[model samples]
Structures are given as structure tokens and as C-alpha cells.
Target: MVHKGNCHTQAVCAVATHLPARIHVILKEDRAYELRDLEGRPISKKDAKALIQREYTVPEEIRQRTRGHKKRRRRKEGYIRSQIRGLVTALQASRFA
Candidate 1:
């Protein structure tokens, strides 16, 4: 059985396996230009920040529930943060490592 965290890792590994060896060099040399060229548009820093914030921001319902219970709230927060961190780490490892 695949654990939740390993799902991200495995998916990254699968994609990375199919990529060319020169991908790392291209990523290092002109990462932004390469991405924009492929996408056919430029991405501003503000746009990138907004995209990330939108993707990673926790929902208000989860945040509201934390006010009701101490131990359960902490556990919920930890789980949420861990999942977010795991996704971020996996993405960084796949793209920038």
C-alpha cells in the first residue's frame, strides 16, 4: 500500500524517470525563460506568488474548527502542515534538486 506522502514522491520519481538528462542543465541555465517559452507567456513574480498562495492556502472551515478543541486542533494543524510541506518538498526536489 502507498502511504500518502510516498504518493507524491513516487509520482515525481515516475516523471523524472522519463525526462532527458539535459533537463537539469537546462533548468539551471535558464529556468524562467524555459518555463515561459514552453508556456508561451511570461509569469510575473506577483502572479507566481498568488498562484502558490491560492494552491497552498488552507480552507477557512479547517481554520475555524481549530478554535473549538485544543489537542484535536493541534493534530489537525500538524497534519495539514505536513501534507503541504510534503507537496512543496516533493516539487522542489523534482524541479530544483
Candidate 2:
């Protein structure tokens, strides 16, 4: 009696090669560049958003709508931020110890 077949064995030790990542710092949001346009003043949020949409492949309408929403929401974003903070603290403690 062959108890372990190809299906069972593959399922038991599935090695994910390229798992999708859930957390990422959007590049534009993460970095700031001196805006020489609009008379050397800081870029308006609206303008900054437009530039981001133009530079990146993101859809325009969605980007505009998402401006008010925080990346760190209490229901979803908050939980992820807490997890990241915990990991960072653990890493720091390990390094010091």
C-alpha cells in the first residue's frame, strides 16, 4: 500500500520561491525632492499627486481619491504597522544584546 503519493508529498513540503510581499513604502511618499517648479515653492499635495500618477503606472482617479486615506488605518494599516514596529524592536534588542 503506497501511503505517500506525489500529491501528499508535494503538499507536505511546498517551498514557496517568490511569495508576494504585503508591505512596501511607496517611493514618492518615502522620498522628497526639491521642487523647482511653481516658483521654487513646495509642491502642492494635488500637484505632487498628479506628478506621482504621471511618473508611475498608477491609475489617476484612484490616486486622487486615496489622498485623504492614511496608509496606516486602525482596522488594517494599524495592525500591520504594529507588527513592523515589533519586528524592528526585536531586531534592535538582539543586536544590542
Candidate 2 regions with alpha-carbon error over 4 angstroms:
1-73
Residue 24, model 1: lDDT of 67
| True-vs-predicted CA distance for residue 85, candidate 2, Å | 0.3
RMSD of each: 18.5, 21.8
Tens-digit per-residue lDDT, 4-66, candidate 2: 222334533453322222112234356554443435667867786776556533354554445
Each model's lDDT comes to 0.63, 0.53
Residue 65 CA error for candidate 1 (Å)? 4.7
* Per-residue lDDT value at 69 in model 1: 71
Residue 69 of candidate 2: its Cα lDDT? 52
TM-score of each: 0.30, 0.25
Model 1 lDDT tens row, 39-88: 55767777766765665454556545544576787999999999999999
- Give lDDT for model 1: 0.63
